[model samples]
Target chain A: MQVTRRQLLQAGLLATAGLVIPALGRTADNSKENLLLSSVTDKDDKNWWVLSDSQGNILAQHLLPGRGHGSARHPSGKSAVIVGRRPATFMSVVEVSPQGEYKFTDLTSATGRHFFGHAVYSVDGKFIYTTENDFDNGRGVIVVRDISNDYKVIAEWESGGIGPHELRMMPDGHTLVIANGGILTRPDQPREKLNLDTMKPNLAYLDTRTGEMLSKHELPDHQLSIRHIDVADTGRVWIGCQYEGMALDPMPLVYHHDLNQGGLQAAEASMDTWRALKHYTGSVVADNQQGIIGISSPRGDRVTFWDNQSGKHLQDIKLRDVCGLIPSPNGKQFVATTGKGDIAIIDAQTLAVTSESRTPELHWDNHLQVLA
Target chain B: MRNCLLILILLCSTFSHAAEREPEAYLKMLNQALKLIQPAHQLFADQAEELHNQIGQLCQSPSEDSLQTTRNQWRKTMESWMKVSVIQFGPLLENDSRLRIQAWPIRARLLTMGIKQLETAEAPPTLEQIAQGTVAVQGLPALEALLFRTDALSGLQQGQACAAAQTIAEHLIVLANTLNQRWQNEFGRDFADPVNTPGGFDTPQEAFDEYMNGLVTAVQQIKRRKLEDPLGLAGKPGKAGATESYLSENSRDNLHNNLTALILYLTGGEGYGVDDDLIAQDPDSIAVLVLDDRIKGITKYNKQLTMPLEALVKPATPEAEAQREVAESIFKELSLLNKAFENQIFEALGVTRDFNSEDGD
Candidate 1:
């Protein structure tokens, strides 16, 4: 890695940030560092997609006109496409160079539809598949964009449920798995669930190349709205749920289903812990190397770990208002963020905090998209 | 060196001023716990203790006068419990103490089973045994059944039921004292993290989030569970006993107290008033003030529901329909308040909703 004059100046300004903070200028020399990407809000309450180095040093920040949710890092390792918060119309394709220079191109959802705040870039870096709403039709959709040609909308398909949220590509690289959270919301009435009486949340799988629906699974209890998800190297989908039923009812918040197994397996936990969760699980990620999964519950104020194969409750580490969770680039640890801007790196084996960092001023939002 | 560099980066890139506003809010939270929540719990404990003594005297020599006095004290104690119940976020949640005191959406099976055991058992339940008893007989609802139910109260007036009633009150007093102690000694300190290190709160934003989340959840619970559920506003047939405090018929007053606190807390009357600051921070502060007004409006509407919630929900008369209208108003206001909470409060505090928080979902 070459350190140019530009790099030295950038580091100086970053280190000697006076009361009047300077804009973080990108260095001309490319430095190979593991950068972590996530959506953030600044002191003025504006939203941004921020990139931080492996040690949690701020690198680059790109402002979004609206709030952002989950982001999709392109396979080419060159850029990321971050979608705006739901009922969201904007998606910003952010370019991150090895030299720490960050740029972005903004795109809008089709009329009468919007990004559900999650998308997946093609493994070959040719296209982007975004979860969207066909709001007028009362169905969800998957819109394919040709990345080479300005993210042009090339194709569309039903998302197989009402409100499709987080989606990821399967290990096969062509099969896209989606969590279709079956709550209807129109732009006019943003974030309002119109159909709790008849919500039909499901875990859906589709072939990315053809938009062909291969499989879809719904919870037996319809009130458990399937939302955020993470797919492992082995294609096991760990799903999280937010229950719309009675608050105190005991409901399973974590589930896993292997694509080949064709059956959804519920993670087993004591009724006490499940009750403590209050029918809410925020983010779900699989620590593939450690053979475990971690789920966060901001409502319960705890992050719980579960064994991947046995679906057994492994451990619970408590934190207030914590949500964003990402397994480390190595898969040997997990980095978790909260609504209060606290970050903790947990040892995957012991489920213990290795180190904790706090950004008392900024609230780290939902998903942390790790970039290598 | 690594820690130093980390601290330098955190200090340089992050804005510390945003954290400064937190102490005011943090102090406000401590004020609420001390001024409102602690005193409310203490009053409930005192009332429960007084009720126990009254029940003891009544049972020692049963009379219409003595028993009526005991029944009246029971009503006072139950209402006092409801006032303290709104502090549902912290220590009250520990050991399922809240449920132990008064489990609502009340279940009759536990009451029936506990009642039969209390009346027919060879030995009257010791406090330890009653403490160990299923949650059903351990709370105010059991007292409601024992006092209001004919066969059950007969056992109590006959001196067969004095011990269980006495035990429940003693247990409630013990819980109240523990709650006050925990809030004072530990949980309240934990709630108001003055320095962010050892304080359960890592930062002021966290303390704010916890406080707002608890308050919003309480308001929603009152609007949906306490009022709308019994009113059958969601189109289900409302049941009579399903209303909170159904036996005592004070669910409306419970709503009033809840709405008052919700309004008071948000308006900066109690402490950590986010509304005034929210309004001042943005030209669009009207939205937040309007939300506060809506919350206050809930208290007014609560007063208009002169009929018991159980009665209002059971019959479809004009008066019942009017009460349902009040319920709907409260529901809509609470819904807007919830949204304002996520949007206004989040913006004022410079925070974002964590992934998949029920707010955005």
Candidate 2:
């Protein structure tokens, strides 16, 4: 086959990325036990919050009140909530009974505030903390909802930055770590980042009980918009960044921080690999089983895994329209979903794709929440 | 044509077997794209080359008859362009090539400045230089202005504007030839068998997605931009100037060519309609049949239209009402096609137009 100059250049870049990220070593976890949850866009332009087994079989699905984004589940695993995507004014809270019956409720955000498409239930399952855009103030805030009292907005707390996205409780169970994305945007423009030059993204730790600011760690580069995150049991916060800088300027995409150590460490991938990541990561999964951090880039159509200890790129899997990622219930595998409807589980250690399925006629959106 | 009738019968009878016939349907799509759609682009290049030659002939001897013949040639070339216009990816996507060929609405200020500069400059810009100039006087739209202007023949007789017209024509041929050559020899051939190449496009499914999406968006443009906007569905009446090709009064033909090319892609050109093959074994071939009728409806309306699209919105004549009816029908047909793809063809085939422009934040 003849190789044109453009083709050769592309091959060179991929080959360079391959040098640091190894071909996935094969290992299989025959587990189909974990239930995965996601917001899906179906063929008929309808949106649904969907739950499936690790094998991607639909277990339960419900029509969302509106278009949805990342979901939050109560620690008990019996209930979950789907937050409407940015600028959407609603949230759906759903509970699945042991008998498989479902109960649902709709909660509205306060005036001038909109859910930023992600919410996390308190570890005790009492309150759900959602990342929201305080559009009037152009700041990110965590809106606390009392699940016991009809999921009402009980309290609000500053996220310590402008655009707080995905947040998770610390391993200690008392502190919540937030990825305050630092970019400012309004509901009118929706996802447009109004402030970039002065944007200050940080990984912030807050006292869950008092809403007191604990510590905030910012990356060396201001242009890197720290957004999505997943927490390991060891308290290392793995972050995925969406760059708000120039498209041509290459920047680090994956990061991890030890709140104890007090600094953000960039997951070291080759420049070629980082470029292939397209300066965007839609989601991140931290596997406790093997300390693997999985980050998905939908634009690049790639899921890259890295070692948490060394911050080294372990392996990279090529997928078309890949975005969602989560560690399976067993933590031994990562269930990855794509906008093209692929649901594949990669073994955390070997990075081998153990099983795969395609949900015909469905487009899985940016985040997948798994109950291990 | 006989084969089409046979396929139509086959499609209607066993429509529920889409799952079983899905692979064959996709393969046929690949084959038809390579065979029928690829040639449409080559024909566009060939016609563009002819137009360049005709413009040169008109410049050599300015006459009313020759100018009229040249205008006819322009219409034919544009129709050819619309026929192959759905191939928006691969070779056609490079270097502002598509926009250079046809920038709509004509940026009046830049065009006036460009023409003024051309007239006043002692050394007029050459074909290559004009190719590098602004889009206003760069391609077909520029040629339209140069030819259709009321003062065209007078300016041609004075040996001014003729060189620029001929130069724009040659530049268009260059772009068209480049696109045609690249598609026919390299990109089109490689894209047909994407799995064979190791650099990217991980699966055969991705190649299918690319082809179908190209056609899908082309159809979308025809419905949303070409027809609705001019017909005052997108805008209020008397705003047909938002219509494409308005200067030459060919917006209806532009739309007709668009739908004609879209139908050509839909059916694979005298072959089984993609919906027919993909939905052949599915229960929803009923939607496909309606879609088929709607396409025929568009063709019928095009045949019956008595005036250009510009008149459809202005003065609100009875014929304008007729045009409005055709526009509404075309809109419904486009919706049916979209639904058929979403519910039956694309779903049964397990492909997703995931990166489609319609997705929200």
Q: After superposition on all CA atoms, what RMSD does each candidate show versus the true structure?
A: 8.6, 12.0
Candidate closest to the true structure, highest TM-score: 1
Question: How high is the DockQ of candidate 1?
Answer: 0.19
Stretches > 4 Å off in candidate 1 = A1-34, A54-58, B1-36, B46-74, B95-181, B188-248, B259-358
What tier of docking accuracy does candidate 2 attain?
A: incorrect
Screening candidate 1 with a backbone cut-off below 3 angstroms (N, C-alpha, C), the clashing residue pairs are A30-A99
Task: State the local distance difference test value for candidate 1.
Answer: 0.73
Which structure among the candidates has the greatest DockQ?
Answer: 1
Q: Report the lDDT tens digits of candidate 1 across residue range A298-336.
A: 778789998877878988998767778888767777877
* lDDT for each residue of candidate 2 in A1-372, tens digit (9 for 90 to 100): 223324434557424322111112222347557778888776555677766665555555667766788888789988888889887788887777665555667788999899888888788999999999888888889989888887778899999988888889888887888988887888888656677879999989988899999899999889888888988887788899987663332468898888879589888887668767756788887888888889888766679988888888887897767888888777778888887667887878789787777765567888888754
